[model samples]
Target: MLTAAIVAILVTMVLALIRAFLGPTEYDRMLAANAFGTKTVLLIALAGHALSWHSFLDVALLYAMVNFIGTIAVMRFFEYGNTRDNEGSGSTP
Candidate 1:
């Protein structure tokens, strides 16, 4: 049962990767990437269960945190133009 679930998740991850590659807009790509990250977390958790390793959950939690932070950074970068030159540029007020 668990093996089947893991396989399904892997399939979803592959589809998400395809979407990330073929997305027409940056936001669409980001969304697909985020979905892949989320599925990765699930995959890790399932693998940990299948292998009887308790440490994988911790790794998954850390991955989730890092993924969330990266998504935020990407969104901010798109919104603010650039992290280093957002304040001093004379494009607008």
Candidate 2:
């Protein structure tokens, strides 16, 4: 059961990667990338369960944090043109 869930997540991750590569608009690609990151978290957790590796959960947690931060950073760049120096810009600061 867990293996099936892992496989499904991997399949979705592959599709998301295709979308990221083929998306016409920047936002479309960003959305796909975000979805890919989310799927990666799920895959890691499933692998942890299947392999009985407790450390995988820790890695997954870290990956989730990084994914969230990365998505926010990307969106901030799209909206403000820079991740740094968004101070007082009112768009992302």
Candidate 3:
């Protein structure tokens, strides 16, 4: 069961990679990247269980935190970027 899950995750990760590369918009690519990271975490957790390793869960947790922060940061950047472009760079006197 664990092996099957790991394989499924690997397939999803590949699909995410393809989307990240071929996505038509920046947001689409970002979403794909986030999905890949989530799948990676699941893969690590499952692999660790299958292999009887103790520290992989911790690594997965760390990766998950990083992925969450990175996604938020990227979303903020995109959101503010559009507003900045529309609002202009000139300071009000």
Candidate 4:
């Protein structure tokens, strides 16, 4: 059962990678990257169980946090980091 889950996740991850590459917009690509990260965490947990690795869950959790934070950061940058509007003001501050 675990092996089957792992294979399914791997397949989904492949699809996510394709979406990341071919997505029509930045948001779509970011969403695909986030989905890929989520699947990786699931894969880690299942593989850890199947292989009897006791500490893998902790690593997976940490990876999950990092992925979430990174996605948020990128989204924020996309939303707020564009300085082109400020460039026209000619104010040096």
How do all models score by TM-score?
0.87, 0.83, 0.84, 0.89
Which has the better lDDT: candidate 1, or candidate 2? 1
Error of 1 at 19 (Å): 0.6
Runs of candidate 2 exceeding 4 Å displacement: 82-93
Colliding residue pairs in candidate 1: none
Every candidate's lDDT = 0.93, 0.90, 0.93, 0.96
What tens digits encode model 2's per-residue C-alpha lDDT throughout 1-93? 777788889899999999999999999999999999999998888888888996998999999999999999999888877545656668941
For TM-score, the strongest prediction is 4
- TM-score, cand. 1: 0.87
Between prediction 1 and prediction 4, which has the larger lDDT?
Answer: 4
For model 3, state the Cα shift of residue 16 in Å: 0.4
Query: How well does candidate 3 match the true structure in TM-score terms?
Result: 0.84
Rank candidates, TM-score, best first: 4, 1, 3, 2
lDDT of 4 by residue, 1-93 (tens): 788899999999999999999999999999999999999999999999999999999999999999999999999988987788789999996
Q: Once model 2 is optimally superposed onto the true structure by TM-score, how far is the C-alpha of residue 54 displaced, in angstroms? A: 1.7
Model 3: worst 10 consecutive residues (lDDT sum): 84-93
lDDT for model 3: 0.93
